[model samples]
Target: MNDSSVGQAGKAATVSARISPAGGLDILSRNEVARLRDVSGSGLHGLLRRCALAVLTSGNISDDPGSMFELFPDFDIQVLQQDRGIKIELTHAPAQAFVDGQIIRGINELLMAVMRDIVYVSTQLEQGGFDLDDSVGITHAVFEILRNARTLRPHVDPNLVVCWGGHSISREEYDYTKAVGYQLGLRGMDICTGCGPGAMKGPMKGATIAHAKQRRRNNRYIGITEPGIIAAESPNPIVNQLVIMPDIEKRLEAFVRMGHGIIVFPGGVGTAEEILYLLGILLHPDNAGIPFPLIFTGPKQSAAYFEQIDRFLRLTLGDEVAQHYQIVVDDPAMVARAMVRGIDKVRNHRLDNKDAFFFNWALNIPLAFQQPFRPTHSAMRELSIRHGRPRHELAADLRRAFSGIVAGNVKDEGVRAIREGGPFDIDGDKDIMQALDALLQAFVVQHRMKLPGGTAYEPCYRVRAG
Candidate 1:
C-alpha cells in the first residue's frame, strides 16, 4: 500500500491489512467497490476513511478532532470487493479498536455505518441523478439517507424520542438525564441522539435498566453524528444503531425527520444549538399548528441554567417562541409524562394528516435550512441576528450564529480558522448581542463549554453589539 498520513508524524505508524465489514455493509457490487475506492473525484474513499477512523476511536472523550488525526494521521480504509461480501482494508488503524487481536464488533458495526452513509449519499444523491435543488428534493434526500441507514421503522409506532444536549456536562446534570431516560424507557419509548457523551449517554444508559425491567427485548438506541464532530465526541457504547451523516445540516435533518418528539437536557452551546435549530423550524408560519413536543429539563441545580436559556430565548425570539417548548426542572417522571402526552398528540396529527410514522415527510423544511452552513469568517460575520423580520427567520439566523460558535468551540475547521486568523465576530442588534454574550459567558463560567476537569475552554467566538 502506498503511504498515507494526515501529517508528517503519522507517516511511520501506518499499517495495511484487510478487515471485513460487519452486518449491513456485507455485499458489494464491482461498481460499488469502485465507487468507494475511487479517489480522483467521484469516489468517497477519503470520506469513508475519516469516518471509519472516528468509529475505531469510539469511547474516546477528546473534543479535538485534530489530535486524533495527529495520533493516527496515516490511517486509511479501503473497500475490497469479495465474492461473499465486501471486506475492509485498514492501514495504520489504532490498536485500541481491537481486543485480543479481534476488532470489537461494535466498532466494526459503527465503521460499517460510516461506510453505509458515505456510499449511499455519494452514489445515490450527490452523483446518482437525484435532484437536490428543490425543497421536495431535499426532504426526499433526508428520507432516503435514513432509509439506507436502516433507521426508519415502518412497523413501529410513533415512540422514538430524540434527545438533544451537550456532549460536555456536569455529573449532577448527567445523572438527571439518566433518570429522565429511565422514565421514558418505562413507557417503552426508543432513544435517539447525537450519540456522544454527557447528557446523550446518560439517558441511553438509564433506559437500558428500564427496558430490562419492562422486558422490552427490542430496544432501539440510535446515534447520529457527522464527520466534523465524531472525532471529538466518540460514539457511546449504548448506541445499537449508528449513522454518520455527510455534514451537520444533514445530521440535524435526520434528527428532526425520524424522531417523533424531542427532549432537551441542560447543556452548553451544543444544546443551545439544538434548541435553536428546532425552534427555528417550529417557528415557521407553515408549521404553526404542528404537534411536535419539545422539553427543556434538568436537575434541581440546573433550574437556573434552563431559566437563563428561557430568558434569552424570550428576549431574542419573543414570548411566543416560549409557547413551543416547556421547561421542566428536577422532575423526571413529569418530563416523561409530558413527553408521552405530546407524542400522543403527534401520533394523532400524523394519523389525521396521512403522514408516515417512520419519517415525518409532511414537515416543511425550507431549502435555506437544509443547505449546509459553512461557518467561514465571512459567513459568520454576515449572519443577521438583529431583531426584526419574521421570528422564524430571525431564529434561523440566530441558529446559524450559534452553529458558527459550535464549530469554533470544537470543530476542526473552526479551531483551525481561529488559529489562522482570530475569533469569529458576531455583530447584531444591541440587546440581542448582550443577551447572547451573557448566555455564552455563563456557559464558560459553568464549565459547560468543555469537558469538566480539562483545560479551561477558550472563547472561539466574539460577540460585538451593533
Candidate 2:
C-alpha cells in the first residue's frame, strides 16, 4: 500500500461545478445542509466523511475500513449551498476516485446519493416523522428510503437477481459465481449484490460480458449498502446503480423488496445472516406460499462448506427449512437454470396478483425482520436462539447474533465492541450451538472471515449452541 498521508492523497485542484439531482435530491434547504455540516462529534459530518471516502475509494479491494482512514486521514467532504442547487466539495480525497484531477462522473453521482439518503434519514430521525417502532412503519421507512433514491423502477419485470455471498471467497468459488452470473445474464437477468468484492463483483463481472453479448442496453448493476458496511466493502465499479441505505436492516429489506430471486454464493457470517433473515421471513406463515427462489451453490470443492451450512440450518431451524432453498453444487448451468425457472414462477404469481415487477410488494416481512438491530453488549446477550419458540422469531435472533459477529468482524462499531469486550458470548440450544460452532470453525479454516494478507483470523464469539 502506498503510504501517503491525507496531506498528499490527491492533487489539490478545487473545481466548483453545480450538479442537479438525477432523481430525488434536486434541492435541499439551507438548514439541512447546516445539520449535515454539524461536525460537532454528534453531527453527521464524521460519518458522512467515512461513507464518502468509501465511495471515493470504490474498487479499492480492501476490506479494512481502518486502512482507508489511515491513508486519507485528512480527507473531508462538504456540501456547498447555492440558490439553484448543490455543489459537493472534496478535500484530500483519494486520488483513484478521480481521473485527470476531476471526480469520475459515476462517483460524483454516487457521492450525491450518499448526501441525499444521509440527509433524509437524519431529518427523519430528528423529526420523528418515521414511526420506526412499528413493523409496517419500519417497512414503509425502507420503501421511502429506496423511493427517495429513485431505485425502484416501475413497469419493469422480475429480472433483478440479488446474489448474496462473502467478500472473502475462494478463487474457485469466485469463478463459479462468475459462471453462474454469465448464464443468468445471457437469459436477460440483471445483477444486484452487497456491492463489494469477491462474489459480489463476480456476478456483475460475468453479467457485463453476457449483457454485451445480448446487446442488452440500459442494464442495471445495482449495489445496496449501509453506512456500516460501505466502509469495509466499497462499491465495485460494475455497480452503475448504487443506493446506500441508512442501516443494515433497511438494506436487507431493500434486497428482498427489489429483487425477483436470490442466489447464495459461498460467504462468511454476513452471508449466513442473510440466509437466516430470508429463512425467517419465508418460514413465516404469511410468506409460506410465496414463490420466492432461494438457492445455495458453490464449486464442487465447496460441497463440504455448503453441507456444513445446510446441517446447521436443519438442526437449528428444522429440516423443513430446507424447503425454502435449493442446494446446487458444481453446476453454474443448473444454478442459472433454477433461478430462471424460479423467477418465472415469481412473474406468474405477481401477474396473477397484479403486483409490481421491479419490486416484490407481495412478500410479507414481519416488523421484527424490518427493525434496525443495533448490536450493543446488552443486545447481543439478549438474543434468544433457543428451541421451542416460533421458528421465525428464533431465526430473527439467530440472524442478529450472526449480524453482531459480522459487525465485530468488519463493521467499525462491532470491531470496537470486540476490542473492548473480547468476543461476544453466544449461548443457545446445545445442538444448535454445536452446529453453529462447527459451521463457523469451518469458515475460519477456509479463510472466509477477513481479507487476506492481514493478521490471522480470530474467533469473534463463543458459540455455546449446546
Candidate 3:
C-alpha cells in the first residue's frame, strides 16, 4: 500500500493510497476497468465509490446512508489495469483503513469483494447471462452470484445460522445476541448476518471467542449485503467474508438460500421485513415440507418485544404461522441446542431430497418475492395486506410494506424520495392496519427505530385503516 495523508484546514483527515487486490479478487477485464472508470450518472463509479467507502470505514455507527459521503466528500476509487492483474487507486479515502502506511488486509479483501461483485453482476446483466424475468431464472442468478463470491461450500453440512435484526438495538438485546452466538460457536456452527452492527455483529462477536475456546479454525464469518443498505449498515469489522448482492430482494434471497437456519433478534422495520420475507416463503404450499430452522430469541427484558411480534404474526398470518418458528427467551444455550437439533433434521431432509448442502434449492420462492420492489409511494399504497388472499401472498405485500419503511429510514434513494414526496401512505384491512400501526408505535416507544444516540427517527410511512 502507498499512503499519503493530508489534514485539510477544516475537513476530516484524508488519505490517498493505491493498493493491490487482496485474495477475494485479483483480475478484471479491460472492459470492466473501463466501466469502473465511467463517471456518468448511469455508470458504476458512483456505486463503487459508495460501497468501497463503506468497506474502508467499517464499523461506522450512524444509520444515515449519506453521512459517510458527506464526511468524505472527495473519497473516490479507480481500477488500474496491469499486466499481472489490477490495483485499486483511492483518492481521499478514509484514513482509518490504513495502518503504518499499509492498508488493512481485511479491509483490502472487502474492498476487492465490492469490486468483484459489482463487475460480475453488471457484466452478466449487460451480456444477458442473467435471466431476471422468471422465478427459476432469478434463483439461478442468486446461486451464480453466491458461487462467484465463493460463499458456497460444496461439502459442508448444514451449519450456517443467518441472524437478522436491527442495527439500532438495545444494549441488553445486543448482549443477548452475543450469548446466543457464543453458544452456537461452541457447537461448531458458522455465522452469517446482514453484516452490520448490533444484532448482526453481536452473534459473530460471541461466536469468535467460543470458536477460539473450542479450538476451531477456518470458521466462517460471512456478511451478505447490497449496495443500497451497505452505507447505512456499514459492514462490521468482524465480517471476514462479505458478499454484496445487487439489491435488497437478492440480498434477502441470499440469506435464506445460504443459511441452514435463522435467528431473529430485536429490530425495527428492517428486521420485520426479513421475518415476513422468510415466513412468506415458508408459508408457500410448495415449501411446506422443507425444514428451515427459525428461532426468535432475546434476553428476558426482550420478552415483551417477541410477544408483540408473535401477536402480530398470529393475527395477520393466522395461528399456523407459529408452526414455522420457535420463540426462546433468555436461554442462549437452549437456543443453540434447538438450532443444532433443527439443523440435523435439515441435514437428513437434504440427504433424502438430494438437495445441495450449500444452498436450499428445494425451497420455492415466487417471482413476487424475487422481483425488486422500488418502494415508491404508490407501491406502498397499493400493498394488499388484507385477508382472503393466500397467506403467502399477503405476507409478500406485507414484507414490501416494511421494506419501504426500512428504505425511508436508511436507504439513500428512499430517504431522498420521502423528503421530496413526504411519508408513504400504507393502507389495508382495518384490523391489519391497526395491528401494523401498533407494532410500529411500540418500536418507536422502545427506541428501536434508530441507533440510540442518533437523531430521533421520524416516521417514514403513515398507517391507514380502510
TM per model? 0.93, 0.93, 0.98
Q: Using alpha carbons, what is the TM-score of model 1?
A: 0.93
| Predicted candidate 1 versus true structure: per-residue lDDT over 171-230, tens digit per residue | 898899999999999999999999988888989999999999999997999999998888
User: What digit string (tens of lDDT, one per residue) describes model 3 on residues 1-466?
Assistant: 5645545412777778888888757888889999999999868998999999999999888888888888898888999999999888988888888887688999999999999899999999999999999999999999999999999999888899999998988899999999999999999999999999999999999999999999999999999999999998899999999999999999999999999999999999899999999999999999988999999999999999999999999999999999999999999999999999999999999999899999999999999999999979999998888899999999999999999998888887898889999999999999999999999999999987864256777899999988
Worst 10 residues of 3 by lDDT: 1-10
- Compared to the true structure, candidate 2 yields what TM-score? 0.93
Order by lDDT, highest first = 3, 2, 1
Whole-model lDDT per candidate: 0.83, 0.85, 0.92
Candidate number achieving the greatest TM-score relative to the actual structure: 3
| lDDT score, candidate 3 | 0.92
Alpha carbon lDDT at 297, candidate 3: 92
lDDT of 2 at 89: 62
Alpha carbon RMSD to native, model 3: 1.3
lDDT of 3 at 463: 91
TM-score of 3: 0.98
What is the TM-score ranking, best to worst? 3, 2, 1
